[model samples]
Target: MNTSDEVRTFTVAPDDDGVRLDRWFKRHLPQIGFGTVSKWARTGQIRVDGKRAKPDDRLVAGQQLRVPPGGDAPHKKPREKPALSEAEISQAKDMVITETESAIVLNKPPGLATQGGTGTKTHVDGLLDAFAPGEDEPRPRLVHRLDKDTSGVLLIARTPGSAAHFSKRFSGRSAKKVYWALVVGVPEVHEGVIEAPLAKQPGSGGEKMHVDHEGGQPAKTKYRVVEKAGQKAAWLELEPMTGRTHQLRVHCAAMGNPIVGDGKYGGKDAFLTGSISRKMHLHARRLIIGSPEGGKLDVTAELPEHFAASMEQLGFDIGLSNAEPIRDDPPPKSREEKKQAARLHAKQYRKSRKGERRGRRDATTAKPKPKPKPKAKR
Candidate 1:
């Protein structure tokens, strides 16, 4: 209903600091589509502090955003979400393990995706409307994701600001997540690190991942064997040092000990015989991350029914293993950071060499001592 031809200017609020320019539009101007925003940005119609801005450009607090008018013009309505049924509402509430003012930790069950995709209908994101506080308030946001078939502790941010906060923790590698998995065989080394690069498989239409050493993104995982079922199976605790798509699954498969029931990577060898369920035996056991409200949020999810049954059948004692989070290895520096560090090191080296050269020059230029006049020919 904004009919004024004049442009509108908004001051970026503190809560929205560091958000992407397009995201700001989505948050503040829901009526405007991403295509429209991108077009406006391309045409230099949108300005941040009197400078043309890109959609992905990060906005700082107190910056003036100049938006051209006509964004509120009538357009095709967005598809409305179908109303949730009673059963769907119950299912969403049932998954909540812990709820704070800023986050909701869910013990997500296997087979439910974190977000929707082609052929994925009953995903966790669709149910998030159940958690919306009110008509005007923003719905909860997914800060992180789990595989459709890999379930465990999934965190949901209650607000956009908190979503950004949690996302930073995850991207910075400060968040600790522990996964429990049952692999086909005990690893030769009881505990070790798996460092492998991964890439999308060539012919799978990006539905699968493979270990691509020569040309792939760096990925690392630290694994410790909790207990073994006489070499037939082993319950392993896995910590991913890098967040790569299907990193853990690919790494474990590459280690020659594919996780039990993961047929995609391991194929026939991934399965176990005699009473083990075919369901993937990987569960996100625990998550520890900084909460928006100051302290840390540490929560553990109980093993899924199939996983628990398999462990019991294998006679593995859950109490025998420690669940403490391993200290995360520092994330690799970005290209810019690496360049900055190299420049600093070179500068220091040059400065030190300069000091040494100056000392040598001073010593060489100083007049030679008389050598105490040869001690008066003593």
Candidate 2:
């Protein structure tokens, strides 16, 4: 074994298909033991692309894998990014729910982008491309996408046919989509539908969708307020009837209650600042889609830390059993914040005024004609 040599990690490209992790290392580095590879998978040594590669982790024709910096690295410098901690990369790898000959399912975490975009080098799609099995092997391709800030079930198709089939279902609205959002206030109407339109803002080559009435695509969403936030915020369960880019975001915004931590659409309480990011409050909670082979497929994703953090900071009671929010007044208010407070305060004032008006009208209608009886008697 070359003890002092450094090894360069290779993403699972087509040329490296059908190779076992242990076998790949043996070929690449003479006599590294199978036990050593296994230990590395357990520890933080060998990784796939930027993740830890298990000994038995089947090498797809193309997947990204890393050979550790120690032990027989290339003579010249290897052009790879700083290798990921075996733990962080492996954590994502472990979230794959199902994998078949034709596709793979992953519950993507919040904060991880689905594919490479501007200023994003490491993403799920690029890693899949690098780790794919062969030139002839079908690459793992995205059928749909979740927001970089939203965590949820994501589907990948291994074949072109599979990709097309899944795409059709999403386009036709045959996919069952469910989402959970932490928003700023309990709505007056608990269960109602929000129908609105979405327009794409194409200025910075980013996927930012806005609410537009005229030149926008049509969209609709139905929501039931799951839990109220003591007039401050609410936890909502949403079912989108149509699939438009950022449909939920725009609809919520149009309803005058943008989600917490959603800075783009004018969310107040949970806007992104230095510590909080824009993606904290929304999650793709669950998905049910038809499998390429046969029956129904369902997957769920756990709430990522950012969403949880918002919950912690806001103290919104999200309908959990026996969960208690701090029993104190809300934080000190600013002048603008006070104005918004007045708007909510007007709700109670208006309700009392309306009651008083109704009472006066009822009294007027109930007056008797005693004067006519007295005149008849006289």
Candidate 3:
């Protein structure tokens, strides 16, 4: 656990033969997680015969195992946040997945804070640090964040370089961000831009950001009516040109069509607001980050169950978005799927044929002789 001290070495006796050096160190140190041990091994902190060894190296009798001394492991329990609780960790395990070397794409459920504050506990930052604490890097960083109640397309960068690269792209307005939201009213036009300057309201706890005076930062938001219904709700595709806080929510509200379930932005007409779809109707649907290396990096997060259900409830066509184009009306089946379906159909046909034959035989066996025998017995 001591980062300032030299790596501690201990002699493994002949009886301790055949165990993995990394596992042994972990068992002995108890504080070193697999990632830290792997990092040490990568950095030559662990050596065999005065040579660096991989984390999976098998230990020999009398082997001098070197355990590196640097960066203490994260405590068993998060200090500042309880949302990073054991329960949440298990739940988020499947939702958080790495797409590229530097960036991790996560499917955040609504109601979970992307970062912590307010009654917010266990933001995505803590969970990511706990999850992907890269062995090569000391601390991972978040490239961009999501609204506390908005779900999907959250990204975390593992290294500083990657973090900087992604942040620059986002800040420079190069990253293409797409969000799907449900609004209380439909815009007259199918697609349009809202270029309203936004400023923070005084004494607003820094949380409430709104369209302000002549000095506010330039903010623009573009929206498309993905689907529309009279006075019910409309599914929308929102793209923010500037990264002002609450730009989409505020702009939508200003347009007289506030996001559904938005108590802050949605006015008196907001009384008929729908349930918080998948945490909130707002989703970080698609993100495209152009790498300095040239080609663009595109990632998309599908509608979490809640959003999809809300779309279905609102009678909106819960199909593909304008983002990615896929072939076929009802997505085409893969080869494996076709083969499996064919096999199942064949089996069902054979079973049906056998049943039909049995039915015909039973019909033939029901003879007039049975009626005669019954009469004789009577």
For this target, which candidate reaches the highest lDDT against the unseen true structure?
Answer: 1
Candidates ranked by TM-score: 1, 3, 2
Pairs of residues clashing in candidate 1: none
Q: Which stretches of candidate 1 lie over 4 Å from their true place?
A: 1-25, 32-71, 74-81, 327-378
What's the candidate order when arranged by decreasing lDDT?
1, 3, 2
For residues 273-295, what per-residue lDDT tens digits would candidate 3 score against the true structure? 44544244687888888763458
- Per-residue C-alpha lDDT of model 1 across residues 200-270, encoded as one tens digit per residue: 99999998999888999999999888888998999999999899999999999999999999999899999
Give RMSD to native, each candidate.
Answer: 15.6, 17.4, 24.5
Model 3 regions more than 4 Å off: 1-88, 133-137, 271-279, 292-294, 324-378
lDDT of each: 0.88, 0.69, 0.71
Q: Which stretches of candidate 2 lie over 4 Å from their true place?
A: 1-92, 134-136, 201-207, 267-269, 272-279, 309-378
What is model 3's C-alpha RMSD? Answer: 24.5
Q: Per model, state how many residue pairs clash.
A: 0, 29, 1
Error of 1 at 308 (Å): 0.7
